[model samples]
Target: MGSSLFSIGLTGLNAAQAGLVTTSHNISNAGTAGYSRQSTVQSTNPGLFTGAGFFGEGTKVDTIKRAYNGFLTNQVLSAETKLNEYDTYSTEISQIDNMLADPAVGLTPAVASFFEGVQEVAANPSSVPARQSMISTAQSLVARFQNLSQRLNDVRAGVESQIKDTVTSIGTYAKEIAELNHKIAVAQQAGSAQPANDLLDTRDQLIKELNQLTRVSTTTATDGSMSVFIGTGQPLVVGTNATTLAAQSSRSDPSRNDVNIITQSGAAITIPENLLGGGKLGGLLAMRSSSLDTAQNQLGLIAVGMSTTFNAQHLLGQDLNGNPGTNFFTPPTVGVQRFSDASTASPQVDFADVSKLSGDDYKLTFTNTTGGYSLTRISDGASVTAANIGLSITPAATSTVGDSFMILPTRNAAANIGVSISDTRMVAAAAPIASAATSGNLGTASISAPVVSSTTDLASFGTAAAPLKLTYSSGNISGFPATLPVTYTPLSGSPITLAAPVASVPYSSGMSIAVGGVSFTLSGAMQDQDSFTLGPNAGGVSDSRNAVQLGNLQTTKTLLSANGSPSATFQSVYSQTVSAVGNKAREVKVNRDAQESLVNQATQAQQSVAGVNLDEEAANLIRYQQAYQAAGKVMNIASKLFDQVLALGQ
Candidate 1:
């Protein structure tokens, strides 16, 4: 009986102490991250064995368990990760939207202003001031284009930098996780449950962060280690070791803006992980590649289109003050020659100095019955044959500047025979001056600025404003001496001729001017064959006068304009930007609201399951106290029994 009573007292004492410790532990870790309250589970000790069977004696601690649900924890983690990604994406989109849509610096207003300037020039074509305004406006417009392009480029560059940073971060996380795997595995092997719970918490936190940088998948090994992998089973971590990730420049051109990820083993991994819907890096990359690049390319295309098309029109039209010259605009070309003569074993055409010439300036003329020739320019380094030109030419020993090759009437006139300047950077050949300059040549000129409010001027210039006039010189030049090298100097308004054996020569309009075997017709007045138009085509690199091509802006796309201007070619780009912003804004608002509701619900559920009840704790304290007192009484009774036995033995 004494033994039974003593065991019961010991059991009670142990139970009370365990309960108190559990309560204290819970209270101590109440604010700890990811900590769950622990409960002391009590169970009756194995019953004392009697003659036939065992009977329950007293209570003892069964197990201490944390109050937590894995499913709920996982739900919270997943939702939080998605919420973080969306928040980052929305924020970045908003910044980009502000950049594109800010009215003070937007492309639309600049485009509108440019077209308006063009209209102003058209209203008063002869006005010097109007023309100057057109030039100024064009300069401003090009400046804006450059500015927009540079800004987009900056954004792209920033994204590239961020990608590098993310790669480094990914590497760091991978290494840390692998190290933790080593530690955890070592602890597990030591025959203890091992403080693995803390390790798991840390690993989970790292995994969440990793998911934000890129897509990742994880697998558990039998040895309590984790293996993390990326796209296509590219292992990031295996057991205690991790592979490193690096950013490398593009293979095709290192200088260009591109990057790729290489594994520790030097294998390039195709990681569009940056495009996955997980992290800030992915969103930033998408923003740069999908939208920013497209916008820039669109702008470049616009510039190219304008340069090519406008030059074509300007080439065909005769400029005022009629100067016989090559077309003002020259587009880029592959320097290749077309052999017009099919029958002739050898036919030669030469333009050693094609610096001042363009393919558009060339015109074919047939003089002999043996005509049928093709002209083709080589592309890249490809050879061109007479067949390629789609026309054949008869034998001729030598081709001169004036000689021409006739196109077969049956052949398609459009087939490659006349490819308009596909590239805007082509250089053209320069022609010789016509009227020689000598002493006593008449050439004084003055240009008047357009009057702003003269009815007569307005009527003349098509603008409700005063008209302006630019003067030119036209007269006989025979009185002056000739055959001497004469330098031509351009005056403020026009070029003055000096030395001249004034050759009075009148030919039908549209007579082709052949320079270095390339021919173009002159539709305006000229002092013999020497007059040339001041065109958009600038001199080539070798020539000092190669100003036009070098001075103009080079672009590949158009910009959207405000006010619905016809010249606004990139309206779609702006429209898409606006749409993206609106969509992101809507999505953010909706998601944020939804998240708030989810948080509230989660909080309520957690409170129900894990919230501490002070009253319950107080009741537990009283119950433990009573149990302790009862155990004390049992001890006291045992002591009394022991004392009585001792007295009897004595």
Candidate 2:
């Protein structure tokens, strides 16, 4: 009986000691991150069989378990990932918002300055100083474009570098997590399937860290292992194996980086960027596509529109040196990239009509269709009509099915724009053609100055030797180009075509007529015979007709037709870009703030279940200490009884 009492006392003592040890451990690690509160599970030892039925023998520890709630923990993780995504996106796009909206570095001020210079020249076309000032302003505009382009290029470089670094970090986390899985499984198997609480906490912490870089999904196996997946269910880790994430150059454009995953069999598969969402990586890519690319492309759009239209009008004008103007700015080239496995059917861009150009990237996919290729605008995922883009595509015989090409029309136009003419004498300020009624005319009929528009389909206009002549007789105009047709636009009607050999036409008081490319207006009464002469503007130094046309381009709606309007001017396009980025930045920031609040709520809930509490641990410590002392006292009493029994035996 004494031996039984002593054994029970010792068992109680051991159980109490265990409880004390656990409580002390909890208190020590109270401030540790990710430390869960642990508790000792006790059960009565198997009672000894006796005549008094089964009597309670002692207590024994069953297991050491942690206080945890998986549901709350996962909620925290989900909220954390979304918050990080919005935060990263907001931070990145705000830079663009600030730069684009700022007047100091923005295109608005530079554009205004440039057109103002043009107006000054129009006010004084014969002044070389004014023309030189226009050139200076143009160079300033070019420098601004280059500066903006370089800044965007720098941002792109930073994004790529961040992607690569993030991939490396994710790779490291995945590898370490896989190793931990092996360790955990081994420990669980060796320890009789008991829970490894500390290891589990460490693993969860690692996952939280990984989520900061990229979002991930997880599943636990029965063998205490886990599987991690990302980007449309692509497995990143299974059991003890970790897949490798590689940051490689894109096949379509070697200058750009793309993410790929090396599988278990070592086959690499490129993960679509859109599929990798809800993390820092996703935020960087979103900023690149939505804000950075659009701003740069829009800037280039303004560059292309201004350069092409201005050059066209300048070429139709006569300079101070009595020479036709050359290009005011260098022509912008369309950017294209071919896929690696695509056929060698190189696509070419024909800029026959600059008005139809857009600030969107296009993808050309060749198939077995009648035209053998389809064009899609990448921005809105819409098919681009030939008339809408105003570009003709002719497929080569060598073109094969599945051939793909990326066309970037205005991607680099800003960077490529430069002044083509350096001499101020190259400024075309006079109209190329001049019109006057013959001196022999007797009627009150007079001709307006020719407004030469197009240079195509027309030969050299009137010169000193042979002036193109027109006659007004019987209220009908005659003497148009004999071999060419004419286009006439009535004052209240659309333009109509007249067949070649246009002998005569009954004229109205205010009639517009086009012979070849030159258009002129005829108004006033005509006599029996009145003749008009059309000739080149020779030595007209004070003519500012072309300068006025150039200045007028500032407000002309020639670009950004795709941005919710039929046409938009340069300043409007830039302003729209700024507004879009600013709006997006504000939106993302709001979402981030909301998500952060949700994260805080979820974290607090998770901590309530798993986090160690010093106050509770202290109470447990005292309770177990008292139990330990009482157990020792019981053992002491049992020792005295056992000693008395021994004495009786002696």
Which runs in model 2 stand beyond 4 Å of their true positions? 263-267, 343-345, 368-371, 379-382, 385-387, 440-445, 457-460, 492-494, 562-566, 647-650
Please state every model's RMSD to the true fold in angstroms.
17.1, 2.4
CA error at residue 468 for candidate 2, angstroms: 2.0
How close is every model to the real structure, measured as TM-score? 0.57, 0.94
Which candidate leads the pack in lDDT?
2
* Model 2: lDDT of residue 88: 84
Please give, for residues 413-471, the per-residue lDDT of candidate 1 as tens digits. Answer: 11111223222222221111111122332332111111111111112222112211111
* Residue pairs that clash (backbone atoms under 3 angstroms), model 2: none
TM-score of 1: 0.57
Worst 10 contiguous positions by lDDT, candidate 1:
445-454
Q: How many collisions between residues are there in candidate 1?
A: 36
Per residue, candidate 2 scores C-alpha lDDT tens digits across 1-650 of 88888999999999999999899888988888878889999999998999979887889989998998878988987898888889888988888788888889998999999999999999999999999999999999999999988888888888889888999999999999999999999999999999898898888888888887888889999989888887568788888998899988887777678889877697768998888887888788778887888888888888888888899899988899988888999987778889888766677775656667767888888876443788898877898765578466666656677888888878888999999878999899888778888888887767888877876643545575577888988878888877778888777878888898899877777789988778899888788678888877776699998899899889988774564444778788788878888899999999999999999999999888888878888899889999999999989999999999999988
Whole-model Cα lDDT of every candidate shown, in order: 0.48, 0.85
Task: Tell me model 1's lDDT, rounded to 2 decimals.
Answer: 0.48
